[model samples]
Target: MRTREEQQSDPYPTTVEIHCLNQFLMEDWDEEWDRISEELEEQDIPVPEGYYEIQKQILDLHQDMSVVEILESEEDDDGEMWYTIIDVEEQKIHPGMPRYALMFADKPYSTDIFLDNVFRHDMRVPDSLFPQTWKNRQAAKYQNM
Candidate 1:
């Protein structure tokens, strides 16, 4: 888990750990991705870089994913990388399963901690309550370079 101070400083961070993931979640991850990739290539579909990471961050922000426990990708037998997002306050991923199961690995990608639009335009963020901002918002908007 990361502290708020940490997130505020760099909301978009990169990681490749398979933290706290279930075996069932990533049953045949590598094969699935390989198949998908081949299919996309055959169709001449442009493969988006940082594909998995971008999707995970979007899901997190949209569902307000709380905290994650990582198991690191290289440690598993199938190299089965996985992680579980848990609500630190409640200590559960909604008292059962998480909002979604996601696959990650291969290419490095930037992931958001929470607030979307805080980083990559390539990322996704659903509609949600926004924090009141002063001129800092304008300052940030202009500071982007």
Candidate 2:
């Protein structure tokens, strides 16, 4: 194992642990699809027929996939740290998967951190929040972008 001094000297000190949101968050796939479709509509993008079915099949496989690479890390306007990650293993296996995710940094594996905050972007869709419940959560909950 690297010594503390060595670890501290490293430019990139991120220790990426493999974790799945599926284990922590009970996602409503219907609400997720609805949010995605609405986001698409707002952007004037066409929602392809059968897109929801395709997304369902992809998310079903996400339970075991956790090979993520942090592509970018930034703090939003509210000062919450968020990381834009790419699911490397899933991308290698299937390009159709929503491989890009924007995840909260403070609570990377917490269900509360992901409450209506999980956003996924893929080749077919833009950065869209899934399973959104803005009505229930506070306005701050919707400011992760």
Candidate 3:
């Protein structure tokens, strides 16, 4: 039988392996996206809205995209910090587009933080906050874009 000292000295095996694999897969996905984007642009394709969605999926599988894993931190108001895990193949449905999907976290802690931090302020304000005319204008922009 191993002594307490022996167990303490030995590091966990599976965790390290998993971490390495995650890192490798993320790098591979990044490279793949670069190549795919170039090809799409060269083909004069409008780069389907689904492209980002698929990239998000790839990042999800490799644990590379947006997620909110709460961490214990003194600085956090709730003593929890957010972390994200990305996996490929997970589809996110958007409000405007049905066929188009985005790659977003399976779970997010703060909608504000997710929009501001994770999405880099790219999200539109909730429709309730906008006037009917403004909403229609925004919709038109999306349709035309």
Candidate 4:
């Protein structure tokens, strides 16, 4: 491993900073959906048809098979710290896996920080946290991009 000096010279953005960007992304996401819904409804068009085209045309998804949402919130102002990406077609393989996530807070000591947080709501004592052997394949989506 590199010494402390090496780590400092090649600094990576911390988790919390990435979380802040996701907060803004979620807000823009909701507002965009709301605007599209309103336009579709005003024109008396089917939601699915309008939404699909608008997502690709206006939102720039280029297809009609992906979904994005904050992990736990009903509105943009809810200030949730995590978000997920869903590929509807790939759901058959994992059933209902949360594809990926990004979060904010102090950087963690272990790579499994998010998985650990999922099992125990408590965060004060790290040792008290139970071991989760379940397979986890995840990483930061851009801690600050």
Every candidate's CA RMSD: 16.4, 20.1, 17.9, 20.7
Q: Report the backbone clash tally of model 2.
A: 0
Clashing pairs in 3: 57-88, 57-89, 58-88, 60-86, 60-87, 60-88, 61-87, 61-88, 67-84, 69-83
Q: Who is ahead in lDDT, 1 or 3? A: 1
TM-score of each: 0.28, 0.27, 0.24, 0.22
lDDT of 1 at 82: 33
lDDT of 1 by residue, 68-122 (tens): 4321212246544333344334454422222234333322343454546575456
For residues 87-113, could you state the per-residue lDDT of candidate 4 as single tens digits?
233332111121122322344453565
Model 2 agreement with the true structure over 88-131: per-residue lDDT tens digits: 55642211123222222332554454557566556563334544
Cα-lDDT of candidate 4: 0.37
Better of 2 and 3 by TM-score: 2
Model 1 misplaced stretches (Cα beyond 4 Å): 1-24, 59-145
Worst 10 residues of 2 by lDDT: 93-102
Q: Candidate 3 — worst ten consecutive residues by lDDT sum?
A: 93-102
lDDT: the better of candidates 1 and 2? 2
User: What TM-score should be assigned to candidate 2?
Assistant: 0.27
Ranking by TM-score: 1, 2, 3, 4
CA-lDDT, candidates in order: 0.44, 0.46, 0.38, 0.37
Alpha-carbon error at 79 in model 2, in Å? 1.0
